[model samples]
Target chain A: MVLIYIDHSEKEIKKSSHEAISYGAAIAKQLGCSAEALLLGTVNDDLTTLGKLGASKVHQLNNESLNNFDAKVHASLIATTASNLNAEVIVFAHNINGKAIAPSVAVKLDAGIVTGACSLPSLQNGFEVTKTVFSGKAFASIKIETPKKVIAINQNSFGIQNYDSSATIEEMNLPIPTASVKVTNVNKIIGEIPLTEANLVVSGGRGLKGPENWGILLDLAKALGAATACSRPVSDSDWRPHHEHVGQTGIQIAPNLYIAIGISGAIQHLAGVNRSKTIVVINKDPEAPFFKAADYGVVGDAFEVVPAFTAAILKMKHNE
Target chain B: MNILVCISKTPDTTAKIAFTEGNTKFDENGVQWIINPYDEWYSLVRAIEIKEKDPTTNIHLITVGGPEAEPIIRKALALGGDEAIRVNSNSNDSYVIAQQIAAIAKQGAYDLIMTGKETIDYNSACIGSMLSAILDLPYVSLANHLEVNGNTATIQREIEGGEETNEVILPMIISCQKGMAEQRIPNMRGIMAARTKPLKVVDPVATNAHTSIKEFSLPPAKTGVKLIAPDQMEELVKLLKEEAKVI
Candidate 1:
């Protein structure tokens, strides 16, 4: 059987988890097996809805301690669950939590593991998988030779499909281990869409001059209902928060539409946002390297172009 | 008061990526290698900061690679480590690398193990977690802020949409990233001192790589961009809506 690990935060399921379930279900179909889901901790979301994404059954471990993430504890329980269920393949979303836990589980199960996988495995060629390497600059095809394999799919890399079925939720009681780590505080960004889950992102850079000039960029982001981000320099200079920084050393996002303004795209910055489905670069300099990587380019000062662009969008919305 | 910092040598961040041997291997021609930035700027420096505060804390550097990794380890030592160790083997497999480090770490009996969040080349952020699993130690990853007090370490890590603060006991593994510490350059005195530091090279233990790279390929090049006039905002809006269908 193929088992998918469902990741959630604050009682809500992450969008990337749906993609993992869909990917796992397709893999199970390829291997002629059943697809199931392993969800740790309690969530307010309905479990039956997971079947629509692909899982045939959902297993829930309802221990309250499981709500807080402890990589060691999570790995041990996940390894046990996979072993008891005779799962030949395991899948997870290569997000923050998955990146921290998947390898430990793989070590426990003695399974071949692939992280940041962007493509489904090809069984015809002995379970070959493709993943982005060199910071999304290139791709590498890897073959997992172990009998038990673990794969973590990259966010936004796979499509989620809806099916006309509901999954049976089975509540399982498992012994919880003592958590070695204690989470004392959590500071969440409220009222704004997270960059990882945002479909559209508007990012600014040093060319915007300083923190005071971010109003135009924020205005556009607000008008479009998109998330806001900044280049590394912008964040380093304190014009934006560190969490809003999107680059190789910061957060890497692959939104559907990414708008870069006043930012001369450096290779490090491009490594993070190059995977966007559609890229639009706006800069006063016509020779910026970002233009080469963008799908659309506009050579103009962001101060003038952004407000005009936002107005045009508002006008279109008013007409619609 | 012992800390083991793991570092790796990787091609400079700005180096152009290319494959050789029919895309089966990375082409190293004309490539300049440096200690991975995350390792040098964050993990290593953070360890040094802790040592500066406690003076008795010992910082040891470790790398798993061939002899070519020696220079990188020496440079890391100059930053503030007491000694260095290089496992005499090189592999792209994370499992093999983690196993070798775990073997040495078990013998060293260090109180804390540290590594960068991930290498820029392969970007596999698993070594710390895997090592923790192998040694049955606690693991904290992507820690941006760390404060060590006695046997407890308070760490702040980035989550999907928030920052989470956790406290873990000593004898744990952590992967560090930006905001942990400022990058420190090796001065002339530190460089002269690093020459006399002890660097031990040990043979790797027997292990099998679970996965093998079959081929490499570059991402498809972007098509030529459609340049829109700055004044034609309405037209750009139409293109995004009707042509790109992204708005």
Candidate 2:
């Protein structure tokens, strides 16, 4: 059987988890086996709905302590679960939590792992999987040769597929270890679409001049109902918060539409957003390298272009 | 307190990426190599800051790479580590690299182990958790802020849409990123002192790499951009809606 680890945030299932389930179900189908889900902690979403994304069974481990992420503890529990279920393959969404625990789980299970995997394994050639390497500058096909294999699917790489079925929920009973790490505080960004889960993102850069000029960008983002992000320099200079930064060293996002304004796309910057389905670059400089990578380009000052773009969007919405 | 800082050498961020050997190996010619930015800027600097507060703290550097990684290791030592260890291997396999670090870390009996959130090149972000698992230590990842008091360490890590503070006992592993510490340049005095720092080159223990690279390829190049006139805002909007269908 193939086991997929369901990741959730604040009692809500993450969008990336659906992609992972679909990918795992496809793999299970290829191997002529069943795909099951392992969800840790309590969530408000109906577990049966997971079957539409392709899991045949949803195993829920309900423990209050499990609500908080402890990589060491979670890894041990996952390893034990995989062993008890005779799972030949395990899958996870390669997000923050998955990246933290998948490797540890792989170590415990003595399984070969390929994180940030972009495609399903090619079983015809000894379980080979393709993944992005060198910060998305290139791709490397990795062959995982182990009895038990663990694969973490890259976010937004695999599209979710719906199956016409419902999964039966199974309450799992296991010895939960005491968490060695104690949670003290949580500061969440309220009332904003997270960059990771946002379908559209409007990002600014140093060319915007200063934090005082950010209202235009925010206005455009609001017009489109998109998330807002900044380049590394913008965040470093404190024009934007570090959490809003997206680049090689910061958060990586793969939104459906990514609009880059006043940003001369550096290779490091491109590395983070290159996975976006559609890229639009707006810069006053006609020779900006970002234009080469973008699907659409507009050479104009962001100060004028952004407001105009926002007005156009608002007008379109009003007409619709 | 003893702290082990893990670092790796990577091509300068601005270097053009190209593969040689039938697209199976990274081209090294004309490429400038430096300490990975995350490792040098965050992980090592934060350790140095901790040592500054407590002069009795010992910081050791470790890397699993070939002799070519020496210059980078020296740079890390110049930043603040007292000693260094290079496991004699150039394995790209995370499992093999983690195993080597685990071996050295066990013998050193360090109280805390630190690594960059992820190397800029591979961006696997797995070494810290893997090392902690092998050592049976609590693991905190993507920690942007860290404060230590006695045996307990308070760490702040970013989640999906929020940040969480966690308190963990000593003998734990952490992966650091931005907000952990500011970047520090090595002074001439530190550079001269780093030459004499003890750098022990140890042979790697026999460990099997479960994964091997099959091939390498670049992302598909984008088709030529459709440039829109600045004044034709409606045209651009129409293209986004009717052509690209994104809005």
Candidate 3:
């Protein structure tokens, strides 16, 4: 059996979870085994629909304590589930929650683990998986010699491919671990598209001058129906919130389109958005490093260029 | 309060990455090594910040590497660590490295053990989480704010599009990131004191590494930038619509 852990937030299933299920199911098909999904906490989305996306069965642990992410607790829960199902492979999306718990689970199960996996394992001769390393500057293919394995799929790597099947939901009464970390408060951005899930992202840096001039970036984002982010320096300087920061140490996103405005592309910054399918850079300095990574480069001041770009996008949308 | 901070010696952020010896090893000919930025700026700094609040608090540093890593360990000591320990193993396996750390952390009975989210070189982001499980301690990752009061630690960790604050007891392990603490530059006093600080060498615990690196390959380089004239906003929009279709 192949088990995929489905992660959710605020009762809603995250987009990455869907991608993981698809990736896991593809692996299951290759190994000629059944793919199943495991959910720790209660989620609002239809578990049956998740089957159509990937898994043949959905096992949910309807425990409230499992809602708040404690790596220790999650790892323990996942390790138990994998064992009970006699799972040969376990999969997780390499998001915040996955990154925190996958290693722990791997240790508990004595499984050979690969995080940030970009492709499915080659089961022809042996289990060989490719993963991103060196902060996305390189790729390393690893062969899992262990009998059981765990893989954390990177976002946007394997997309969701639908299957014409409905999953049977099963409730498991398992012993949930005691939570040591108590969530005191949750400060969440209510409505906008999350940076992790957004297909297109509009990010800025200190090059925009100050926080007061952020309206142009927002306008472009709104016009394009994209999420917004900022470079680490922008967040460090209090020009934007830390949640908006994306870099080697910040949120790693692999959107289809990433628009960087006024951001000089440092290698660390590139690590975060380098996986983006299409990068568009807008900066005044012709020698800015970001352009080298961008698919499209606009060499002009962000102040003059961003507004004009936003206007043209709005015009195109209006015409559409 | 006794805090144990784990740091890694990595190539400087701007160092050119190259492979050597049949692409099996990293070329270190001209690379300048430094303490991983996240370790220096966040993990070690936050522990030092806790120590600064109470003089009784002691901060110790540890890294799993050889003599070449001693200088990086000294850098952490100069930043506010009381002592340093270098595990005598240059293992690239995160699991083996975590075992070494868990062994030291277990013996020390540290109230808090912290490390960066991941090392820049390997970028495994696994040591702290694996160590937490091995030590049977509560663990938090990507912590932006951490404040310890008595036996409880209030930590605010970064979440998707927001933040979540959690309170965990002492003897917890954390993988820290930015916003935890400001960068502290080592002053002359720190540099002088760090040289005389107790630097201990310890043997690594015997454990099998689950993973081994095979080879190194760089990402495909960008071909060429398609520069669009700044004034031609219409042309740019048309290109995006027709060619890129991103908008």
Candidate 4:
């Protein structure tokens, strides 16, 4: 059976988890097995809604302790669950949680595993999985030669297919190990959408001159209802928070639409956003490296172009 | 305190990716190798932080690769590790790599195991998790902040939509990511110290798994941009509604 780990935070389904379900469902279809889900923590949404994403069953641990993630405890708990359910294949979104838990799950099960899988497995002969290599620069087909397998599917790599199937929500009586660490305090930046979940991202760079002018990018992001990002230099220089940085040295993202303003794409910078589906670059230099990577390019002053772009979007919304 | 950090050698970001004859293998010609960026930022840095926090701590670094990877392992040693171990194999599968590391880790009895959230080369952040399972240790991935106090560790991990804070006992595995630690540059002293560090090369243990790389390919080039005049807001809106279809 295909088991998918549903990653959520404080009651909201992660967009990436939906993609993982789609991927898990496809694998289940290919393997002629049922697709089941394992959720950690408390999510307020109706668990049955996962049926639309292709889960045949949803195994919920649902304890308050599970709400705060403890990787070691989580790995042990999941390993126990997987073994109990006799799971043949386990799936996770190649996002943060997947990266943490999937490998541990593989080791616990003594199973062969692949992470950042971009495509479905080719199961005609054996279980061959296709995954992105070289920082989204290429692809390689890997065959997992083990009785059981683990896969972490990348976000936006597989499209979620809507299916009309009902999934049963079952409560599992798994033991929750005591947490060894205590959270002293949490400093969360409110109001800003996490970059991974944002469909549209407005990013800036050194060309913004300083943090004072970051408002232009923020304005554009607000106008487009998007998240804001920055190149490594901007983050390193403290023009933006480190979490807002997207580059080889920062968070690699694959959003649907990424708008880069005033940033010249360095090789390191491109490594992060290269997987974005549609990239829009706004710069004064027509020959900037970012233009080569952008799906859309505008050669003009970001100071002038960004506001106009935001105004244009607002104006169009008003007209509508 | 004892720490283990996993590393992988990956192609440089600028390499033109291609497949070999009949798409059977990755075309490695003309490709330059570097330490996987994520591993460098997350795993390596976190290990260094532990070492720096406690002067008596021993940081051991390991990689599952062939003889050609010795220089990279040495470089990692230069970066701050006290010793190095290289499993003599070329296994690209995460499971195999985890098995190799787990074997070494079990023998060394390290208190903490760390790896990158995902290697930038394959972007597969699965090794740490797999190793945790193999070793029967708790595993946490994408830990941006980690602090060890006595026998426990407080880790802040990035979740799908937000962050989740947790505390776990040590002797567990952690996959590091952004904000774990600042990147470190190898100074002259570090470079010299790395050359003198002990690097043990061991043959990979035999395994029944016969995982193989069947083929390789490149993603299709992105389509050209649909340019809209600066003043054509209606046309742009129409395109977003119809052609682009992202509205």
Count clashing residue pairs per candidate.
0, 0, 0, 12
Candidate 3: pairs in clash = none
Q: Share of real interface contacts recovered by each model?
A: 0.79, 0.79, 0.71, 0.61
Weakest 10 consecutive residues of candidate 1 chain A by summed lDDT: A62-71
Q: Write the per-residue lDDT of candidate 4 for residues A1-320, one digit (tens) a residue.
A: 99999887667778889989988999999989999999887898888989999999999987877766656677777888999999999998887666767777777787777787888898787888988777777788888888998888888879899999878999988778776445555555688788877778889999889999988788878888888889988888888887888887678898888888888898888888888877878778888888888777777787877778888788877887
Identify the superior model by DockQ, candidate 1 or candidate 2: 1
DockQ (model 2, Cα): 0.81
Models ranked on DockQ? 1, 2, 3, 4
**C-alpha lDDT of all candidate models, in order:** 0.93, 0.92, 0.89, 0.80
- Give all candidate RMSDs, comma-separated: 1.0, 1.0, 1.6, 2.5
Q: What is the DockQ of each candidate?
A: 0.82, 0.81, 0.71, 0.54
Backbone steric clashes in candidate 4, count: 12
Chain A only: TM-score per candidate: 0.98, 0.98, 0.95, 0.96
A best-first ranking of the candidates according to their lDDT comes to 1, 2, 3, 4
> Which tens-of-lDDT digit does each residue in A28-90 have in candidate 3?
999999999999988789899987887999999998778888888889889998998899999
Error of 2 at B175 (Å): 0.6
Which ten residues in a row are the worst by lDDT in model 2 chain B?
B117-126
Docking class of 1: high
Interface RMSD of each: 1.0, 1.1, 1.6, 2.5
Off by over 4 Å in 3: none
